[model samples]
Target: MESRRRTFLRIATLELCERFGFYGLQSVSVLYFVRTMGLSEQGAIMLWGAFSALMFGVPVLGGWLGDRMLGARRTVAVALALLATGYTGLASGMGGAAGVSLVLAVLVCGGGIFKPNITSLLRHAFSDGDDRLDIVFTIYYMSINVGATIAALAIPFLAVHIGWQASFGVSAAVLWIGFAVSLTLPATAPPPAGGGDRRLWLLLGAGIGVAFTLLHYPALAKICIWIAAAAIVLIWIVLYRRAAPIWRAGLKLSFALQAEAILFFLFNQQIATSLTGFARDHLAGTIRLAGVDWAVQPGQFQSLNNLWIVIFAPCLAALYYHAERKGRPISVPIRFLFGFVLLTASFVLWRAAALAGAAGPISPWWMVAGYALFSLGELLIAALGLAVIARYAPPDGVGRLMGCFSVFGGLASYLGSLVATYGMAGSGTASTAGYTHLFGNLAALSAIVALASALFIPFARKMDAHWRHAIPRPSSTDKTPTEILP
Candidate 1:
């Protein structure tokens, strides 16, 4: 038990450090681009969407490389080095749109590699059927929130007080520290996918460049994302056709759910994009709490999701614990269904806030309420999604499937960018009616997604049953197996 706990701590610490550095740059990115690079609101959002797409999208290849080639530890070290270099480069003021885009490409590529590999490593660290998995993940989730909360609070303030470059430099230094710490940890037993060659490396290089180029042009990026999503569906279809009869249903259902997962992220991303702009443009400068005035900055509102997560995660864990003890624990699909419901409620709350703002700048509490609801949904869906994928994915290709799952996040960013751009169309100049239209549309979209997810729950439950009984469990003593792959 002590050994397992130590392993968990090591993995959790690595995750925390990575998120801290990543969010430090991301928390203030919109403002930095707008103020320093002279980007329009829409332009900035689109760029962010592109950056997000790569961060999630590239994981597909990264997972392949990690699981099949270099092992997770080596992959992590290489990724962190790339991340630190990108941060340092940007701190030196990568000039203009093209230059900055290039630097971000490198940064996001590192994240793509780091994200899925670490997750795969963590999943592999435990024996199958370990009841402690959820609790461990809950703590892991909290670690992420801890890092994100600190970055959200500190980076924005630092950017304002000192300089934007200094904030990036700080992020770079922190990433280097994470890299150093990672080396001291116990090594993971590598999985059996290892087959990368020179050609694969060259193709990966090309893919990164293409991703950067597309992101540099938002219109092109949007079009390309749709194309990529379609291509992914086509690939899944081909795989399903060739798959063993027993595995087809699971594949079909998993793919459908992953595709639908995009909708959740579509709504989720407004926190960073549209919500930031909304807080900056519409909220009162100061909020009054208990007869004391508090200054509020729009960037600070970005931290609210993390803040809510820290507060709500333990409550969620307790709920799950009690439920599991009673033999009525929540299933993955049920969790997703509940998540969609909460997402709809969150948007409705935001719409109400937008309506209240028509008279004048509204209180920050409105946003607080909305984010709290959304954060609950995040805990239900996003935090649990990784575990779900790990559970359902074929034992031989867990990392690859997880990578594919991350693609939905990319698609969501693309779609969410469109929504955010529409939401902030007129920004400082839009009339009350314009804001009303924006929030109403978002609310309607959220409701539709929730309804759709509800309809799929029955099917998901059935698929869940089929998968659990079908996949062969590894022997208790066999911690790693190569035969599962080929």
Candidate 2:
């Protein structure tokens, strides 16, 4: 148990460094596209959306590589190298627009390979049905936010004071540092039984082909994303059919929860696009705290999401831990409903702020308050998303299912970006009305999701019971399963 705990910590450290680089780049990416790349605001938003979509969308292939060809550790090592290379390319600024696009292509490929496998590697340290999985994953989630919060605060500052290229260079440096740290960690999973080298070469070839396609064919890339999404669905159907009868209920529930998670990601996308735009166009640059006014960069507002997550994640994790100790732990489905409720309130709060500040800039406090709710909702839904897969997904194919989760999220992210684009007012136009309408629409959607979650509770509980009974207890010493509500 102590060794497993140590393994989790080391893996979490790797996650922290990876997120530091990833979110650092994301913090300044849109503005970099607008200010440095000479793209229009809308174009920048769409480009960011596309980049996000691909970052998530490619994980299906990555998960397959980890599950079937390369082991989790090897896959992650390769991904870290690719990510560092991509960030270095961005820092170099070699080819202008084309150069940046090519670098983005590298990032998408690297990110796709990195995201799912790392999480799978972390989960590999624990046995199936370990009661501590929820708390462990929640803490793991917080590690990600910890990295994001620091990067969010620091990278934007660097972008503003130094140069954009310099900020990206920092991201590259962080990843290389992570790669160095990774060497000391023991392998948590073994390589495949055979053909690992042959398959590694094949995946490398395929990755290069993918990068070339993304660099040269923008429209084709979009089409490929949709095609990949369709393939993911088809694969899910196949997996469901092939799963043992006892495992089918859990897999179905996992799929349902992941689908619902898509809505949360839609709202999540606003932090990068519309919300950042709002901060730049409407809010004051400096926020007043206790006694002093502190200046803030618009990009730094993105940090609020991570900051709030860092503040609240441990609290929620403790609550879950205590509840489980009493054998009345809060279920993931109930948490999902609560998440949507908070998300609804967040959008409503933002809408009220937009309306109240009709005459002039609003208080940055409003952004702070809105993000508090938004981040809590994120903790409930997004943070526990992997927990859902971990608890319910078949042990044999959990890695692939994790990738499917990313695919659903990527699709939602792209759709959310489209939604944000509609709320974007033209360069010289008043944005208040548009933002108000957008927030109002989001609030309504969130309410509808909340209601659906409530309706689905009974079904989810039934599925939970089915899964609990179907799987044998791992050992005599394993803790009893928490009681599910009738």
Candidate 1 lDDT score at position 202: 72
- Residue range 147-174, candidate 1, lDDT tens digits: 8988887887787788888888888888
TM-score of every model versus the real structure: 0.86, 0.87
Find the candidate with the highest TM-score and give its number.
2
lDDT of 1: 0.75
Superposition TM-score, candidate 1 onto the true structure: 0.86
Give the lDDT of residue 421 in candidate 1.
74
Provide the lowest-lDDT 10-residue window in model 2: 477-486
Q: How would you encode candidate 2's per-residue C-alpha lDDT over 297-399 as one tens digit per residue?
A: 8889999998888888778878988988886878777988999999999999999988876889888999999999998998888746677778778888787
C-alpha lDDT of residue 405 in model 1:
60
Badly placed stretches (over 4 Å) of model 1 are: 1-10, 123-135, 188-208, 383-400, 423-432, 458-486
The TM-score, computed over Cα atoms with residue i paired to residue i, of candidate 2 is 0.87
Model 2, total clashes: 0
